[model samples]
Target: MRFSVNKSEKYTVLVPEEEKLDSLKAPQLKAEIVTMFQSGTENLIIDLSSVKYVDSSGLSSILVANRLSTEVNGKLVLAGLNEHVMKLIKISKLESVLELHPTVQEAIEAIFLHEIEKDIEGEED
Candidate 1:
């Protein structure tokens, strides 16, 4: 539940200060994501560099974030995933479904690029 939320015009970055993202912290994470999305904050970057373990509940929370982003025409990016957490995501078959980045900077840049592409597409329309 302990996390930091950094919001800007482009995106919001959530850095959870927990080593294990399990059932105990999943609900809080989901709630925050939903709240942000409902408040019209779309693009999100979840930096999980500090998390060494994750469970099904954690994965469910992530899925919620992704779904909310999709519904809001936004993007939910996961960054700084360690080896074990990455394996968990892959095993859950979310490796292809979710946006994954090696670093927070890359994730932010990716979101920016996507927004640019969307803006271009909008202009064409």
Candidate 2:
């Protein structure tokens, strides 16, 4: 899949430039996410603004990302999902599990907020 990775202080934003996230590109995406996690990236935000379609394989890849992030006490968030993608996630009953935001900025903010909360809890501990 054609994509770009932007790294910031506490999170990484992956923007896929493909129109459809299908079996052909999902494996590559999943591999990349694994690599990022292994490299110490924890918080992840996937920007789906350019994606119009996502198949079951794509959803599986996303779930993999979420699992990887959670394994490290981080977060995986999705943003800018179009109607079709949103419908697919809802139909799959993943809406309650996956974090969704209307924009990348919102997702980033949420990530930072959660991080701060975690830090506060750690201090208490």
lDDT of each: 0.93, 0.97
Cα-lDDT of candidate 2: 0.97
- Candidate 2: count the clashes: 0
Error of 2 at 125 (Å): 1.0
User: Could you tell me which residue pairs clash in candidate 1?
Assistant: none
The TM-score, computed over Cα atoms with residue i paired to residue i, of candidate 2 is 0.98
List clash counts for every candidate, in order.
0, 0
Off by over 4 Å in 2: none
Residues 10-113 of candidate 1: C-alpha lDDT, one tens digit per residue: 89999999999999999999898889998888899999999999999999999999999888888999999999999998888889999999999999998999
* Candidate 2 lDDT, 14-84, residue by residue in tens: 99999999999999999999999999999999999999999999999999999999999999999999999
Query: Best-fitting candidate, measured by lDDT?
Result: 2
